[model samples]
Target: MSRSKWTNIIFLIVILLLIIPQTRLPIQVALHKLITKVNSIRVLEEDNSVRITDTNWQLKSEKGLLKNLNQSEGKVIVINFWATWCAPCIAEMPSLQSLYDAYNNKVDFLFITTDDFKKVSYFKNKNEYSFPVYQPYSQPPNVLMTKSIPRTVVINAEGEIVIDESGAVDWFSEKVQSELNKLLK
Candidate 1:
């Protein structure tokens, strides 16, 4: 077959695959994962960074306990807003889990989602991820507000939003580790 014919055939196959829900999801997740593998989260410059004016946000733990963000004041915090149905969120979860494994003790990691705890728990168990997940009990601070899922924000001990990313990224990258270490010190 000619190159153009082969290209047209491949394009048609992709289109047909996307028309089916079952096949579409996996393809979308795979594409998202590929994007994340190549992309590293970028830290905002000091001037461009936003400061959290309030730490009074409330979060409900997976265990049904209410926790205050104020408790993490003066500590490095990783807050990810994601949903179980979000393909990009699912794609980046493994990297987030790896990052959590390495920094859970030293940093505050909050995998915030709007999904019911039951569903979130099922997803976590199925993926064998042990990261702490929470539901927002109240409105998050304005600086942390986002209109999209899979948004992640990293706040330093000094309360500066150093990293605010709105899509999937390799959370376990060397740059992320270095940034977290710097924030810790």
Candidate 2:
């Protein structure tokens, strides 16, 4: 093949490679921005009077035994479904503990782990958290029909599932505090 032809082909391939990502750059940026906006806006029900039914799911407390969360009535219950392997779950744990310490008596904070009782026991011993910890039954919670990790559900005093967020969230954010405050009130 002629050198010019070869040069032209190479140039065309280079141009295509460069142009493709550039062409998609705008879409990628827009999608990223959209995701940021969506995550920033917390979706919560405006009507705060809805009450959640008693799920009666058994959860293990920090003491390494099964306990029922439904017994803690007339208080805000924050049930965090986390696993020891989840980085986000570990990162937000301190914040959850802080929140629990601030309102442990007034509100019930349950850190429900799907991990086996042995692993949970080791983790609890390694890191001492003041909040109550529990292991959900081998099955997932009724409210959270799915077995996805890092799910945080905020049940109000009336047992209504107020905030059912799946994935890592800024639990310490003003939005979360506001929601918790509203529930407390």
Candidate 3:
């Protein structure tokens, strides 16, 4: 077969794979993980960043505990808005898990989702992720609200948003670690 013909065949195969539900999810997640390798998450400048002044946010933990966002005030927080069915969110879970493992004691990590608690608990256990998962019990402040999944915001102790990134990201990357370390200090 000619090279062009081979390319066409490969493209057709990919299209077919994407059309299949079971195969499509994993393929999309893999593609997103690949994308994160090249896409770096940056910290925003102080003047350009938004302060999280409203701490009235309410969330329920996976363990059935009601938690208030105000509890994290004066502490570094990594808040991620994600859903169980989101491919990009699944893709970034490993990196987020790794980050949580390293900073759990020093930083407050909130993995917020609108999905059912049962499904979220199952997913967390299946993936062996130890990060705390929460469902928004009440509306969050405007700064914490997003239309998309896998939206992550890192806020320093002073309540300023340092890194607000959407979509998939390698949370365990050195650049992210360096930024978090700076915030911790």
Candidate maximizing TM-score: 3
Candidate 2 accuracy as TM-score: 0.67
Clash pairs, candidate 1, are none
Q: Report lDDT per candidate.
A: 0.93, 0.68, 0.94
lDDT of 2: 0.68
The worst-scoring run of ten residues by lDDT in candidate 1 lies at 140-149
Q: List the pairs of residues colliding in candidate 2.
A: 52-159, 52-160, 60-134, 60-135
RMSD, model 2, all Cα superposed?
9.2
Off by over 4 Å in 3: none
lDDT of 1 at 170: 93
* Candidate 3 global TM-score: 0.98
Candidate 2 lDDT, tens digit per residue, 19-122? 79654444443443344334532545758434656466777665667767667677888888887766556656666766777677777777877677678767
Runs off by more than 4 Å, candidate 2? 1-43, 47-50, 138-141
Question: How close to the true structure is residue 159 of candidate 2, measured as C-alpha lDDT?
Answer: 74
Ranking by lDDT: 3, 1, 2
